[model samples]
Target: MTAMPEWMSPPRAEGWYAEDLDHLPEAPRHTELIDGALVFMTSPQRWWHGEVVTALTIALRQQAPEGWLVGREMTIRLDKRNRPEPDLLVTTTAYDPDRTWFAPEDVQLVVEVVSPESAHRDTTVKLRKYADAGIPHYWCIEDQAGAPVVHVYELDVPTGAYAPAGIFREVMKRPVPFEIELDLSTLTP
Candidate 1:
């Protein structure tokens, strides 16, 4: 057996657990656990990013039914090792307001707003995680010329993956999960 080089060493402890995230000051804030691996986030990446996330979170919260919650940039524990902090997510069940993370089963929808540093992860990495966890809805919002463009997906039960539902630019009206009508222009502006 050969020893691994220092440059090739893992970022954190091997087979990281969700509870370990609680101890990292930057975690569940600027870090995430993906399949037992630690992934750092780009904080304050863009001013528009936070604004859009706030808009979507508010929209989802208003439409959420009783016992449901809309979380922003909070961790969702998909398993013992996979705790991903999505930009926005809707939980099917209400939280105690002090919980650190959510179970995958309670997450109905997950949203990600792409940034230059996280474009690949937001589109491919997190997309696969949410699909594997069987989240009913996923929305990928991209900023184009200071406007928000949304790409919607619905889980395909037979394949345990997501299928394209629709793409919205100026406005979005959806009935699944809950009734929501969001003005997309307001998100970036």
Candidate 2:
């Protein structure tokens, strides 16, 4: 028998899996599966979001150490039921060149640019997951009145959590993964 259409069918009550996502159409995207639930993303990201994501990706890529890969809107497999697509993330040398999703150990840092609907998850939910996975670093980027504000955190290994490292509104220069100099103002298109 032919398999039923996923995109057209009603939501699954059984929940979603990382593998199940692979069969869906690429266009008319929906939310990333989190803990097997179809959790929706915030309202569509405005143009500024793209500009900021692009700018941050470029700045991070230029300084990323050898063997590190910077990706945008890429999914990281935290577990069988949880797959989060961070806005931007830097993967370590462990990143498999042939793979689409990354393992926790393969990720050195995960950055999320907050949207009105995603602030809670980016700040609390994802923060906890990344910390528990021992991803090491997390950056929460928010655009306030057109200027990006960055909140940096470093993992407190003993606690399996992240400790606030810094809150940068303008010049974000820090030593995490590497020394990064990101100018928030430039991200606005």
Candidate 3:
């Protein structure tokens, strides 16, 4: 077997830290830290995933209030050892050119466009993690016959868990995280 690349080695005995992602210039793009380990998104992105993410980013940006910001494929530093990159995020923080990852508290919503390779993590692991981190909103978008179906959830502050708000297809409208409506059909070509 070929030897592992030097950059692939963990910088600490406990595995990778969230902040370490910034210093590793040679690490692959979209690298994430989960439970103190590096997780790389190596699978080729499906065209549907890319299109939906781009379209959603645009749609969200258009409706975002002055203080809100919409971003795509940005990592959220949930904790010292967990920084998962959601497909899309809506934040209250102002634009910062040098910002690499967002703090969970600053993010109002996170959208994950589910791909086959990420279905389990997106539906289960991340679902739990994002809620535990106190993010107010989470939307997991799944492809149903080439159309995007959004599963929206809101945090139950008392329990520190997510409560299903709605599952939207064709169109999605939400009041919290700012009022916005989206025609899901337009997200895919």
TM, every model: 0.87, 0.87, 0.98
For residues 1-189, what per-residue lDDT tens digits would candidate 3 score against the true structure?
999999889877999888899999998888888899888887999999999999999998899989899998889999999999999999989899989999999999999999998899899999999999999999999999899999999999999999999999998889998998998999998
- Which one is best on TM-score? 3
lDDT of 1: 0.83
Predictions in order: lDDT: 0.83, 0.82, 0.93
Q: Relative to the unseen true structure, what is the C-alpha lDDT of residue 6 in candidate 3, on a scale of 0 to 100?
A: 94
Query: Residue 118 in candidate 1 has what lDDT?
Result: 87
Better TM-score candidate (2, 3): 3
Q: How far off is residue 119 in model 2, in Å?
A: 1.5
Stretch of 10 with least lDDT, candidate 3: 33-42
TM-score of 1: 0.87
Q: What is the model-wide C-alpha lDDT for candidate 2?
A: 0.82
